[model samples]
Target: MLDYAKVIVTGSPISKSNFKLFNMHGRAILPYNSGKYHDRYAIYEQEIAFCARLQNPNIVLSQSLIAVLKVFYKSEKRHPDTNNITKSIFDGIEKSGLIVNDAQITRLIIEEFYDSKNPRFELELFGESRYNMKYEICTKKILDEPKEYGPPSNKKNSYLSKKSTFANTKEAAEDSKIHCSICNKVINAENSVTANNGKMRICKDCIKKLF
Candidate 1:
């Protein structure tokens, strides 16, 4: 069973959003990559591919995976939003052929730290095979138990039905008053705007503050 695979790419990390440029041709506008960013990304991809291959030689994972990224920055001045750096790392993992696609990653964890001496990022990929085994074991244990596991009893079902009915009646009674989605404060209908075609109710005070 494969537990996890880790690869570390050593370099000053770059943000995918910061190095884009736009070009105009006639009346159309198009986005292009900066030369410096292109060169740096090429190097990053190569390093990631090399490290991943060394760790998991001749195998590519296709199972549902969890990815953990630990990023170290050179200094506080160079720190950027952690999300901005994920695109490059995910793209690199795809280009490396370590996984069939980055979309296979169902869970992601990210941590940022300052490491002036080693400004780099570490990627850890965890396969779900182990978790699946544990889940199967748990299910078998539950099945072996003496107690019966099935639907609710008639009395319990009646209680749940009554609770649901009460909730609906309460909602109908409060229909005249709108609750602000942000602050969750009850306000009169006139003071609230039905945004997104009544999907969202936001009070005027909140709208002014947010906008």
Candidate 2:
């Protein structure tokens, strides 16, 4: 199973109030009289940049995502309900292109705490599989049978880094240039992603494989 990945957003979380709606005659409607939509839209624009190049290779669109949020307050003694902020959070993530839709998040766990020094919500999106993945465990489940886990190993996966020495196949690496480690094809250095922490370089197409 793949581990849960994290995305850190450094800002005061915008409340769901920004997405609030007014009630008409037995109907609910988004208020168009205010600039809330414009403000929220601007926020979404800035948030998408953070989601760039943040996909995991082993997991993509698992259909099962759990957003674990740690909300920190600046100076408030009593914090607002975490659920109340979920709408804005979901909208931000969807607009950020992290997930196809907010409904894709089948599971959500939100908790609030005080971090007066640094007030922001830390979000971690956990994935399971392509369609029906299971990435979480219920805390209420009985612990009488502790699940067995294997010991950690020091071995690393070098499938991508196996061609790190591609320069030997051609001219000297210094005289030549880097190539896509996965495809073994040459591409621009600026466009490539640092594979295996600089051990290898991959193009945009190959980097998508990581996710």
Candidate 3:
């Protein structure tokens, strides 16, 4: 079964651009994140790590990962750029110990929306094998029965209240199969050659023909 984790960080998102340049003895200059940004990032990273450990205790940090981020902004007029915001979030994920490196993220999906009342970001981490799963299905599964960590809300958010009734069940163990991209056929892992620096696989036969 594919492993996954979900986390929600409640706060105004901070952008990576909030950095200051420091000069040492007029010889070298270094960039440092603003104190406000650093503190915010620490909180976000701690929350993510806590939720990940509780949800997927056996998750392997070395495997490839996929990240789905839903960003909510209090206003659209002067919000930070999406790309800049993601940089801070990704760094938080790496520091959370959920993954050894952010480079393991093979796929990422980001959705932005306006939520003036509750400005927060929801993150879902999944194994690389989950790439083929439908977006709705993956999201619905991950968000089900969420274990919230933020402040208590007297009333649940309308968007979060609509929980899926789908039961979590293990499907056939097909996630282990490695399919060749060239011939579109299943091939043994030992007999297949990785293409595009391990982003894809190709059977020996197909590799011979192409080469």
Candidate 4:
């Protein structure tokens, strides 16, 4: 089973010799056939290509593993080989002792992909207290007008600051008291700074000096 996971990580075309080892498991493992880029390969190249688009390996494996598991689970009732294939996969996962094992991948798959009730944890990495306002502004600018900044002037650290990124966007109006006209920095509920306009919005503290 763990070996099947390797089908995605190898980043190469599948060969007959290596694929033969798993072929004995039969068609239950057929979805993986799509993983192959070569003739007679079962794994779909599109599946792997989608994973490759992600910059993060954990994200890639997490998606691919989940997709493969779902195909097996859904087909189990219709396919006689399904039960045996699923069992073999679990068994292989246990035997391989891979640090990046299937269980963790399974959790990610269920929580992120399979389980509708599961709460998302991706944003949890940034706790509420640490949620970055300034970074959000910078990211928005990059996404909206990405062409403005070419491949980073400094390739090493390409992250742009909000102030620097949105320095030129015109203010909304003089009377708007609440918002930072330049980047929508809001005035606080408690200590609101009145902009040239009288409208209340986000506070200056929300705006960071970084960008």
lDDT of 1 by residue, 3-111 (tens): 6778788877787665444446444321334455445555665677777777677668888898889999998654766888888788777777888898988888888
All candidates: TM-score: 0.54, 0.46, 0.51, 0.18
lDDT-wise, the better of 1 and 3 is 1
Provide the lowest-lDDT 10-residue window in model 3: 163-172
Preferred candidate (TM-score higher): 1 or 2: 1
Model 2 per-residue lDDT tens digits across residues 59-173: 3343567667788877554454567777766665665555678786777778777777887777777674532334665676555866453322333335334455564555585
Off by over 4 Å in 3: 25-60, 130-211
Better of 1 and 4 by TM-score: 1
In TM-score terms, candidate 1 sits at 0.54
Off by over 4 Å in 2: 1-4, 18-60, 130-211
Estimate, for each residue in 1-211, the C-alpha lDDT of model 3 and write its tens digit.
Answer: 5457776777777775554234665543223345554455455556655765665566656678778999999986657778887777777767667677889878888998889999988888788765544556344634556445432354456434443212212223455677899888989989988868899999999988987
Ranking by lDDT: 1, 3, 2, 4
TM match of model 2 to true structure: 0.46
Q: On TM-score, who's better, 1 or 3?
A: 1
Top candidate (TM-score): 1
Ten-residue region with minimum lDDT total, candidate 2: 150-159
Which regions of candidate 1 deviate over 4 angstroms? 1-3, 23-38, 132-211
Computed on alpha carbons, the lDDT of every model, listed in order, comes to: 0.76, 0.62, 0.70, 0.33
lDDT of candidate 4 at residue 112, scale 0 to 100: 15
- Candidate 4 lDDT score at position 173: 44
RMSD of each: 19.7, 25.4, 22.0, 20.2
